[model samples]
Target: MKNTIAERIFDFLKDFPPFDVLTAEQLIIIARNVKVIYLPKDKFVFKIEEEIHDHFYVVKDGAIGIFRKEDQVLVDECDEGDIFGLRAMIRKGNYILSAKAIEESIVYSISSLLLEEIIQTNTEANKFLIASFATNTRNPYANDNKGTLFANVKSLQKNESSLTEVQSAQYSKNPITCQLKTSIQQAALIMSTKHVGSIVITENQKPIGIITDKDLRLHIATGRFSIDDPVESIMSSPVITYPENISVAEAQIAMLQHKITHLCITKDGTANSVLTGILSEHDIVAIRGNNPSALIKEVKRAKTAETLQHIRKKVQQLLQGYVEQHIPISYISKVISAINEAITQRAILLSLEEMNTPPPVKFSWLALGSQGRKEQLLITDQDNALVFENPPKEQFDVTKAYFLSLSEKVTQKLNTIGFEFCPADMMASNPRWCLSLDEWKNQFHSWITKPDKDKILLSMIFFDYEMIYGDKNLVDEMSESIFGSIGSYKIFLNFMGLNALKNPPPLSFFRQFLVEHSGEHKDQFDIKARAIMPLVDAARLLILSNNLKGFNSTIARYKKLAEVEPQNKDLYESCINAFRVLLRFRTQQGLKNNTSGRFIDLKSLSKADRLKLKGCFKPIKDIQELIKVRFSLSHML
Candidate 1:
């Protein structure tokens, strides 16, 4: 049996990753054979191209740097509970990079023979080995690029069909033709009846010209040509033509180069030949893909709740497509945001229609928390607030009741759609969150001026409020009030800045992750609170200090900061990149486990992923330093 020290180590490892997959007895067995090696700072464990060792290493304490000879770059750093030196073990090949202690560190070296024996029996452990050995061949968070994860590969494969077809282009098979002498009004009638955005103008069953929505708007609508004018008067002559066999990709490119959305498929591949069909961008999009915009339109036009549900299903398909394509998380965030916003707006519209009376005054719908920041991926509980215009004292109770009823109806529809009610009853349906504009302003004032820990927490949750629907003026007025309050209480930003530094990047006691010391989630890393939120809260606080409004998104704030401070441009850009990597990792993990990717089981992550994640924290440390110096927050700490 392993000693208490090794048993404790095994206990930590088992909760996190490959160790977690092993039986407790198996872990204790492996732990007994572990060589706990300590190294001084900057000591090399192994050099690049060195023969593979019989064992791999995991950071038990402190940080270890994995350096690549090429450019002498510090590829990644392995923190507490992070694995390293395993790729060589998996491949039985020489080490590709050198591993060195970045700081004073203790590493647990597990015998490869023992690992193999465990893997042969442990399916989960073996699968993890394969994953770690494959794509993680190089540091994903190297100086040059943020690494893509397993989820990226899955997302790429998923989006392949639509992306492939988009590159190839799909054309209509049925051609709507017209004689050259056909009156513009008649052609317009046919287009209207067919519900097509563009129509082909043909003569003798041959291609001639094209008339599109743009043409009609420019010529007929602008009085450049009369309704009775010959179709040739406004039709685009020598239309952009492609052969019938052109792929969707080729067709899309051809249309783009010609600056047109419609591509005519002709028999002889020329404008003079017989026209086979017209291809619209919309047709191409509908054939092989689902787009968020199309889904949004469907949501708006949906006649029934079921139809909206269908559109929501389409949104999921789009999300799957995006995730598979390895589309940037920011883009995915925006697309999801638009779809979520559309659903909420549609729900509100449906509720309004069901209501017996129009709202007495302008009221705005607010999306709180992650949804408000437009970062929600998987559906979570609804966090909403309502801000209605203040009414006379006599009508106050009545107005509040009316909005409460509306909130109840809206939240119910949202629940039906997907978003569950907030467990704490923090939703707009709650009396506290559903308030008048003046009341909200007062709330902000109280939170900022008389800030206590609870008030500060409340402010953090409430400050991220995004106006979803209703009068623009009301939202703008609310923002103005916030700025006015912040301007008077500059210390609010300092307090917020201090809050951002609360987690200290979770670097080890020796400049690495301070892994969970015990319990159910023991050794499982808390990546969210430690790595992501510090950056998020910092970005929000920093941006607010600049008096910026309506930019709650972390990336957008960094981009804005980069623009405003040219001297600190590189730092802001780095923060953006770091934030993206961490967010992407969290999302990928969340998707994999079907839970919030906040607490990461270290054993499950490949040696490379663990290192990449550790690499992301460097910028976090740097940025925290900047925040400290800038805000004079050292005293508070």
Candidate 2:
């Protein structure tokens, strides 16, 4: 007998996971046995400590929130085709969470017997189940798990290789060594001859201590110890040691934790063992070619903007590799950001050398917009400002002139290094942007208090300010002042919230993408404006409302938001996952097209690619709704 309801259920289930992996006959059999249940808003499908149901549920429509018992925090939200109540059923225990309909919901309840009978047999289905059990969410792109449950499953198995983090570090097997009785002068000559920074002090092939260029500078050069003195007189005692098979990650952590540059690799994993080799920070940097330390070293050594430009080009290539390799976006962003900061610091140093005199007052170089957020992957226009300490009124004009001249030099250097000048003249070279700390505070206060369209736009960009160079105190003071202004006029957040909602996720009622109707990007999607900024704006507003400071990246803010708002952990986690996907997608697009990945051609995407892109939209919509309610923006809008 043909069953229309069962067919409909199967249709919906086929597009989703676990069921998607099942055979048609297998899904049909399970769908026919499914019991359809209706739930009103706030109605619980199951409560904490209740006996486990015979069947777990799949949401056909509306939303079901799984709440923790102790605090009733919403740990996860199940929407259309989302499965819930399965973990407890699998474990055969009383429910640990209560599943409630946050909105009127229709759910398809499937018996556990059928799950065990059919779904458990399929490998893909099993992987999905495992991910769901582990993360309590359907999406396999959990922050901890880099990709989908099925993503790279075969490639990972076939490769049988480890990432750099886990791969065995390549240490220098032929370590430069000297006897404990060797004179400092002799050891120094050996180091110079070997072109090495450190020499291990050994006895019977066992390392007892070590000395480096720093030791030479502090002891011999400072006249604290004579060059003729024995190396033991200045050698650092009880050298840190690791085994021959130490991984890169372990080596880095050991170095940081001990505050040492060199580690003695031994026959065994302890100091008592015979020294096999040495691993220096430089070795680690060399192993990881696109490493932060290596890039920063190059930046410091850069004599001209042309050299920095070459380094920045390498950064882009590094970024492309990271995206292709599926490295975590957070890790990539931090490394890239550190490199960018180093380049800017070097640029400032070069600029200062060009100036006639040092700045009359202490000042900070601020990176605005994406650079400030540490989320910039592709090269984009330069958005920056300058903030200097307040000088005496009489010295103000002269101080301003000096900084302005310095800003011109720095901005020109950055331009030469491929950070194109912001078309709107938002760079620090602009007199309007280069200001004293008090002037910046006043500027922020005006924007917050007045609240206009242009001001709000400026606020969205400038509020993400981070100091690339100069006095930390100045940036801290500016943050305090901005927050102070916002606190006095709480309504400013509403305007920001409204602006966030302006570019809603680029989807229409028919679920078709809403691409640009007219412009150079006609029929193309502006992923940056429509998808990325909404999340960025919402995160900034929420963080500011909480009076939180120092969270500049959208991902970091969302993580912090999850920490402070446990009830919304699932939502914030979803946002983080969504943002990461979008960011990675944009970066990949940018790299492929050789343009800023802001505009995406809808026609160019494969079905799976489109689905992946569409997957990110839900969190943007959810977060905007949260912001709307939180800030009371609905009425104003």
Candidate 3:
């Protein structure tokens, strides 16, 4: 008797881990006895110390999160076709860990007795499960035998292992809820009995307000209220609530913004919704991984620009760790960029609060130059601008003044955050740079149409603009307008192409690095002017010529170029490698001297480092040659 449902299960299971090792006939036999279960988001499939089910489960859809109860660590996330619930069944003990649906899902459970019988005689299958059990988390669907079984092997002080500040905060599913009218005596008893510090006052299963020990201490212990009073009488109304899918960064930000210790987890992310769980601040720091994402956490709590500046200084340490860890420079850039962006966002939000009122029009803050490109590994001067929505003629001055004042505040905060004020006054605080959308469009038009040397120089600097805060749509429109201007004035690209080759790879006639001859620092290599800028210039030219949108970082632009021009894949890849090496080399130098790594003491470099630097220049030269031919710049050459 072939069951149709079992046959469908067999077809799906045969493609995933552990089961992939079994024969079709054996999988069908197992599937016939499989029990399918549905779990809503945030629902626990199995909880810590809970009795093990007879079967091990595999995700048929959505994701299952395996959390460590002891530390509240999101140890591993099981996605489609990933297996869970096996080890406990294998050990035949109460679950030491908890498995919950991170998303709504259908899970197929194969009976443990049948699974053991099926795999016992199969040596390879047994080895696979044992290895998975050992690792605690093997992505069996992946070609590599990587898993997270021993992820909990760290000591109690293992907060330095991996940063969980970005991972989801596993909330207490069973929150202590009491009616708003419940006597303070009853609520206090519940808190003592449950060993919890907070009690949520709910109305019709919805969180309305909350009472914590602090509220009790400040109100009751201080003789302000009696225990016999209603819980609502002293409760803080309108609770802070987050959805089930809050990340550690968001949770940290929310807590910092509200200055609260616990957040109610609700279904629809509102106080009016049904309460699902409670996320305590302790749950956040408990799973804080070794990753210096604590910088992001700290940035959230920053009250003044000085605090952000302090946090920015600590970011270098995180950068040093990533470099020491041999993490890819691209990934390092992303992490650093996220931190920088977060600091900027908090600064803007703080500035908004300081303003008399919010800006009258939508506006976006743009980070230009290195900060804009997100390649500013070392602390550098802030290069930013603002583009506000066009206002009616009568309201333009008032609106512009409000934004300029706001920009001034934000820029000052950013300066304190370690981004030095741009010497050229290119920041949003500069009235010349802070413009209406129409003004920015006109500005971009002039830059594209006219190729004067100063305009050309500024054009290149401005083209790498990335939105740091505000309405993203303005940035999109700005991009479309810039490209539109280029389409009309196609000759501008040639001038831009010429600029890309202005700083040739710094090699002397004899191939020695062309170090500075008579500058303030003689015999010093200009990594930025020579190596870094050439690749940056080439990426900008090639990507802009292709009219691609949104590829801002030099490395990202190169990767995109490689994808579009597969013929130059090796060249693009080499350029990417070279850029990373140069970027890191500069970063390490900057760290050592506490100055921008723009200049390198050539005499200090080793023979191998010299060779690596020399190797990077070839791609620089090759790319420039391509840019020259593409734009017909041989005559200028």
Candidate with the greatest TM-score versus the true structure = 2
lDDT of 1 at 28: 83
Q: What value of lDDT does candidate 1 attain over all alpha carbons?
A: 0.77
- Residues 27-119 of candidate 3 have per-residue lDDT tens digits of 878888888999998898888889998888887765687876432656566655667888887778999878998767888887888877877
User: Can you give the lDDT of residue 491 in candidate 2?
Assistant: 90
Where in model 1 is the C-alpha error above 4 Å?
A: 1-167, 171-196, 199-281, 303-310, 516-520
Query: At residue 34, what lDDT does model 1 achieve?
Result: 90
List, residue by residue over 360-390, the lDDT tens digit for candidate 1: 8889999988888888876678999999999
Residue 521 of model 3, lDDT score: 79
Q: Please list the Cα RMSD from the true structure of every candidate, rounded to 1 decimal place.
A: 12.0, 9.7, 14.5
Q: How many steric clashes between backbone atoms does each model show?
A: 19, 0, 13
Alpha-carbon TM-score of each model against the true structure: 0.64, 0.68, 0.59
Off by over 4 Å in 3: 1-292
Assess candidate 2 and give its lDDT.
0.83
Clashes of 3: 13
Query: By lDDT, who's the top model here?
Result: 2
The per-model lDDT (C-alpha) reads 0.77, 0.83, 0.80
